[model samples]
Target: MSRKPSTSHFLLLLIIIITVAVSAARTSAQSTSLCPSSSVNPEFCPINCFRPDPVCGADNVTYTCGCDDALCAGVRVVKLGPCDA
Candidate 1:
């Protein structure tokens, strides 16, 4: 005779699946949130004008021309100013 699964067992499995899904989503978000320096591609970047609006990048480097330069450098801005000395 085949044994039916218990309600508690099903609930536990469901909880595990939900937890795994949430964890995976968070991991994906975190990984995508930061652009590594190795991915820097400045080919399409706008010309670096004389503008000097410094923005701090997640890599602790300062992008003196704001987010445009930061994105071109494959870096995520951490703040809107130069990194602390």
Candidate 2:
């Protein structure tokens, strides 16, 4: 016997896709609002203000190397150095 995709399966897939898309959009919007228009994501909005060890983030912001990559503010570490100006 051969089995085919069911309607429920399709609906579930669609729901998952929509959820993911919405989440991505929300994140994008947040980044735009937080970071400057010239930047991509709000990976570095200076929210992690502290002693500077010259660490750059994925969104082109600087942070201290002392701060762990797992920032509670949701910033992603790109490199352990000052961002290119």
Candidate 3:
């Protein structure tokens, strides 16, 4: 004879599956790090300066900017979508 799962057993299994799925989704949605260009001038660096075309991954949301050298400045962040571009 075969036994069926009790309601509590089914609930527990569902909770476990949901927890694992949520964890996986969170991991996959993490943002990537960005580095500024190596030739940016600090004196002219705008507080909100960012590149028009940024290289981004799936979870790009925030950005950080800094000058690396003396001629080029850049903003780094995961690529935001068109709305944020």
Candidate 4:
């Protein structure tokens, strides 16, 4: 005669699968970090806005305003226009 699997055995297997899935998810989530070019001293950084003004930085990255280029990006302002221009 063939033996049937017990309910407790099935429950244990389901718990193990759930635990492994959650552990994998947390590991992946923690692997992502802030970009290196972002502001190191964010306490004095300017608030971002949607104004039409834009400025280019010495690093060639276009920022939304002068404060972003100088304070947030910690780079000198290269020009008063977008870097793509």
Better of 2 and 4 by TM-score: 4
lDDT of 3 at 60: 39
Which is superior by lDDT, 2 or 4? 4
What RMSD does model 3 have?
A: 8.3
Global lDDT of model 1: 0.79
lDDT of 4 by residue, 1-85 (tens): 9999999999999999999999999998776432224453678656666665677777888777554535576676656767875
Off by over 4 Å in 2: 34-85
Pairs of residues at least 3 apart in sequence or in different chains that clash in candidate 2: none
Candidate 2 has an lDDT of: 0.61
Candidate 3 lDDT over residue span 1-85, tens digit each: 9998899999999999999999998887663234443444467555454544433433433323322311232333434332254
lDDT of each structure? 0.79, 0.61, 0.48, 0.68
- Where does candidate 3 stray beyond 4 Å? 31-85
Candidate 4 wrongly placed segments (more than 4 Å):
34-85
Clashing residue pairs in candidate 1 (N, C-alpha, C atoms within 3 angstroms):
none
Superior by lDDT: candidate 1 or candidate 4:
1
Task: Quote the RMSD, in angstroms, for model 4.
Answer: 10.4
**Candidate 1: worst 10 consecutive residues by lDDT?**
32-41
Q: Candidate 2: how large is its RMSD? A: 10.4
lDDT digits (tens) for residues 1-85 of candidate 1: 9999999999999999999999999998887733244343578686455879888998999988777788887777888778898
Q: In candidate 2, what are the lDDT values of residues 1-85, reduced to their tens digit?
A: 9999999999999999999999999998676532223332345544444565665777787765423432534666666677789
Residue 73, model 4: Cα distance from true site in angstroms: 6.3
